[model samples]
Target: MELGRLLLLQVFCAALDAGTTWLMWSRIDISVVLARIAGAFLAAILIVLFCRRAPEFRGIGRFLATSISLTCLLVSYGIFALLMLRNPVLQWPLAFAAASGASLLLSWIGYWRARQGRVSG
Candidate 1:
């Protein structure tokens, strides 16, 4: 896929995840909701940056990529939120950065696997 389309997909996924997170958890605390939303965006951007042509994997692989992306977003936000609960100070940036880094690492691995020529599609 083209870069623009890939980015649009990421933004769409991030926005959907953020909207859902806000609707579900915004009642808890405004900060947590916003942080998780930001984390979701960061995960997509960082994943794209590290993964590059990761979206090229197609067929059923395309669905798997999207599923993994969503899963990673949730997991990354959950980890950041849990860590923030313990510190509750100036750790939001650090936690989000780490989460983005983790997402990047995960995407890089996926990109590697996608290029291994073993996947069906």
Candidate 2:
């Protein structure tokens, strides 16, 4: 259940990121593709760092979490690239992908830390 929730959260975050990116691109006339890619990459790095620092998820789920984080970043960027256009509704998939990816990464890190503590103890 927690994992499911985390997945959902990741998807949500990704969506938000995509939306924000689109908004920025539309309003600022900036390079939407570059901005969106950069945002996802930055988010992924942050997720990994945060998970690593988290006391709970130190070692147990590190790999899984990192995978999720990486996936979400990739999905977010991919989806944005594929769906971001004049049409607003077509972008949901990318957003969801990004969010799910982030959640998984975070969860993995937390689990990893907890396992390490247990093993040491």
Candidate 3:
């Protein structure tokens, strides 16, 4: 993706993460909100880096790397959101699993769309 699009994606993802955090915590402090935004921003940078290098890998390797990066990007916010929610011990794993599953599903959809030439990046 071009630099502008990547930056836009990063900002959008960070805002989404921040919004989700605010919605979950309801009365969270500004510092925690900033932390969530920073975390998401970092994850987005890592994803962009990985995507830039993805062409170096061949076939399935490229696909897996891209997919994993995308998954992590989505899950980055969930990690903080889950921690703040602080559900019961058993529910913690369930929540994470659900988040991960959803992230994977979303990642796969994006990958499929890219493969079908439906998305530019």
Against the unseen true structure, what C-alpha lDDT does each candidate score? Answer: 0.57, 0.57, 0.51
Question: What order do candidates take by lDDT, descending?
Answer: 2, 1, 3
TM-score of 2: 0.52
What TM-score, computed on C-alpha atoms, does each candidate reach?
0.52, 0.52, 0.40
Q: For residues 1-121, what per-residue lDDT tens digits would candidate 3 score against the true structure?
A: 3323333444455455545545444565454535555546655675667567645432234555455556656665566466546743444334444554565455555545444452343
> Which candidate do you rate higher for lDDT, 2 or 3?
2
Off by over 4 Å in 2: 8-12, 19-23, 57-60, 85-121
Residues forming the 10-long window of minimal summed lDDT in candidate 2 = 54-63
RMSD of each: 7.1, 6.5, 10.0
Name the lDDT of candidate 3: 0.51
- Over 1-121, each residue of candidate 2 has an lDDT whose tens digit, in order, gives 4344445546555655667666767787786666676557656766677557644433345555556556656754655565555445655445445545544565556545555666897
Per-residue accuracy of model 1 over 26-105 as CA lDDT, tens digit each: 56666764646654675566555544555454423555566556666777676677777777775555765676567545
Candidate 3 TM-score versus the reference: 0.40
Candidate 3 regions exceeding 4 Å error are 1-39, 56-90, 118-121
Q: Is candidate 2 or candidate 3 better by TM-score?
A: 2
What shift in Å separates residue 70 of candidate 1 from its native position after superposition?
A: 1.3
